[model samples]
Target: MKVFKVVCICTIYVLMIMGTRPTVSLFAHELGASINHIGLITSLFSIIPLLFAIPLGKKIDHLNSKITLLLGGYLGVLGIVLPGFFPNFLGLYLSQLIAGSAQTVLILSAQDYIGRISTKKNRNQYVSWFSFGVAVGTLAGPLFSGIIADLFSFQITFLILAGIGFISCIIIHLVPNEYPIKSKKSPIPTSKTKSTFVDLLKIPSLRLALLFSALILFAKDIYLTFFPLLGLQFGYSNSTIGLLLAINGIASVIIRFYLAPITNRFGTFNVFIGSMIISCVAYIALPFFPQIVIACIIAFILGIGLGIGQPLSISLTIDNAINGRVAEALGIRLTVNRLTQVITPAIFGILANLIGLIYIFLVSSTVIALGTGIAGHNKNNRKTDVMEDSRVKSI
Candidate 1:
C-alpha cells in the first residue's frame, strides 16, 4: 500500500476522534457535570476499547484491515453523533464509549497495515508522516470544534463533529486500499498470532515501552479533560480553551515533521525520556499559571515533549514485537494504554474534586516522571537502529 493512502485513511479516523474528545468534556460541563462525572465520562471512552483491544488485534491478524476500517468508521460516526442528537449526560457516555471502541479497531488496522507495508529503511519516516497526520487532525479538531461551539452551542459542535466522523467514513470507502486483504487460497489461511501475555511480559523492553506509552497517554488524555476545567475556572470561553489545547496540537504537528531525524539522532529511548522530563515540568507548572497566553505557551512546550514520545514509543513497540503479531502487540499496547486511560481519570476526578484540580497535574507529573525513569533504564532500549527495525512483531 502507498504510505500516503494509509496515512490519509488513518488521519481521517483520528481527526474525527480528536474533534470529539475535548469538546465533549466542555459539553458535559455545561450539562452540570461535576469533576467526578467529567472524569467518569472521560474514562468511558476507553472502557470498550480496553475490553476489546486484544480480540480486535487478533481479528486483524486473521481477517482483513479494510473491514476493520469500515466498522471503525461507522462506529466513530455513530459515537460522535449521539450526543448531538440526544444532548444529555447519557449521550456523553455513549458517545465516548463507542468512539473509544471505534478508535481501538481503527488504530490497530492502520498500524498493522503500515507495519506490513513499510520497509526498515523507510519505516521511521513513513510512521512519522502517519503520526504527523494524527498531529494535524489533533491540531484541527479542537480548534475547529471550539470555534464552532462559540459561534453556535456545544450541541451544534457535536453535530459538526458527527459530520466530520461521517466524512471520514465516506473517505475510507472512497480511498483505494494500498494493501488489499489476502485472498483465501484454501478453506482458510493460517493465522500466526505471536507473543502470549506471559511471553510478552518476559521481554523487559517491550513491557517498558508499553508502560511508557500508557503513562504518556494517560497524562495527555487527562490533560485534555482537566485543561478545559482549569480554563473555565479562570473564566475563559470554550473557544479560548479549545485554542489552548490546540496550541499543543499545533506544536506537535510542527515537531512531528522533524521527529524522524530527532529519533535517528537521539535514539527513541533517549527522546522518550526527554519528552517525559518536559511534560512533567510543564504539567506541574501549569497549576501556577492562570493566564491564557502563558498556558498556551506552556501547552506548546508540553506538546513538543508529548509529540516526540508517542511515535517513538510506537516505533519501539513495533521494533520489539514478536513474529506476525505486530497487530496483536499493538493491541496489547492499547490495552495497557486504554487501561491507564480508564483508571487515571477515575482516580483523578475524585482526587481533583476532593482536594483541588491542580493536584491532578501534580500527581500526573510525578507518576509520569517515575515511568520515564523506568523507561530510561529499560533493558530493551538498545534498539536504537531504526534502519534495522523490520523484525516480526505483534502489538
Candidate 2:
C-alpha cells in the first residue's frame, strides 16, 4: 500500500512538472510575449508558492491530507488544461499561478504523509526514495513534453499532461488514507506564539538548513530558466535544447539512486559539502567551454551534484524540525527555496541581457561555494550539540 501510494504521488508530481515548464518559453513566443513577460511568467510561478506555503502548511496541519492531495491534483489538471484552450499570455500566466498553488499543497501534504509513515531508523532512506521519485518525474517531464510538442503541438502537450494529472488524481483517490499521528497534549511553542516564522528563525540549525536550501535552488533556477535561452543564443534549435535538458534529467535520476546510499554511509553533511563543491566546479567551468556538447556535459554534471544535495538537505531540515512542526518546518524550507527561485532568475535574466550568460554561471558558482561554507558551519554546530547531549547523559 505504501509502495502504491509513493508511485501515485510520484506520477502526480511528474505530470505537474511536465505541464508547468519545458515549453513555457515557446508558449510565450507563440503568444507574442516579450522577454520580460516571459521572465514574469516564470517568476510568478515561484513567487505564488512562496507566498502561500506557510498558510497552506498551517492548513495541512489540521486538514485531511488525502482530501488535500486530491484537490491539489485536480487543480493541477485545471491549470494545465485551461492554458491549452486559451493559448495566450494571460492564460499562460494564470496557468502557472494555479499550478504553483497546487504544487505547494501537494508537496506539503506529501511531506506530512511521509513524516507520519516512516521511522527514524529508515526515515532518511524513505526520504531518499521520495526524492528519487521526484527526480524521476522531473527527468521525464521535459522529454515527455518535448516529444509531445514535436509529434503534435504544444497545446496538445498541455492537454495530454492534464489527462495524466487526472489519472494521478484518480490513483490518489483510490489509495487509502494513512491517518496522521495524533498528539495526547499540545506541544511546546518553541518560543513566542505571535510570530511562527520568527519562531522558526530562532533555531540556528533550521536557519542554516533554510539558507542551504535557498542557495541550492537558486543554482537550479539559473540553469532551468537561462539554459534554453543560452542554447538559443548559441544557435541551437529547440529540439537540441530539449535533448540537452533530457540529459540533465537522466543524470539526476542516476545520481539520486546511486549516490543516496553512499551519502547515508558517509553522513549527509559530508555528501552535502562534497556535492556543493562539485556543483561549484561544474558552474564555473560551464562558460569556459561554450561548445554545445561541452555545455551538455557540464549540465549533466550539475544535475548529479543537485540530485545528491537536494534530498540530503531536505532530510536534514525535516530531522531538525521542532517536534510537531514538520509541516511548518518543511513549509519554511520550501518558502526559502521558492523565494530564491523567484528572485534569482529575474536578476540573472537582467544580468544576462546586460553582460552575458558567462557571468550568470560565474555568479551562481560563487553563491554555491559560499553556501558550502555555511553548510560546514552547520556541521560543526551539530557536532557540538551531540557533545553536549552526551555530557548531559553522562551526568
Q: Estimated TM-score per prediction? A: 0.90, 0.90
Where's the lowest-lDDT run of ten residues in candidate 2? 183-192
lDDT of 1 by residue, 1-395 (tens): 46677677677667778877788788888899899888899999999889889877866866666788788888888888888889998888888888899888888888887777777788777778888888888878888888899899888888877787776777677655544334223222334753355555566678878877887898788788888888888888878888988899999989887886887799766778888899999998898898877888899999998888788778877777765667777898999999998998888899998999988889889998888777665544555543246453422
lDDT, candidates in the order shown: 0.80, 0.75
Which stretches in model 1 have alpha-carbon errors above 4 Å? 177-195, 379-395
* Candidate 2: tens digits of C-alpha lDDT, residues 118-203: 78887777787888777777777776777778788888888888887777787787766766555323243554444465666677
Model 2 ranges off by over 4 Å: 183-195, 288-292, 378-395
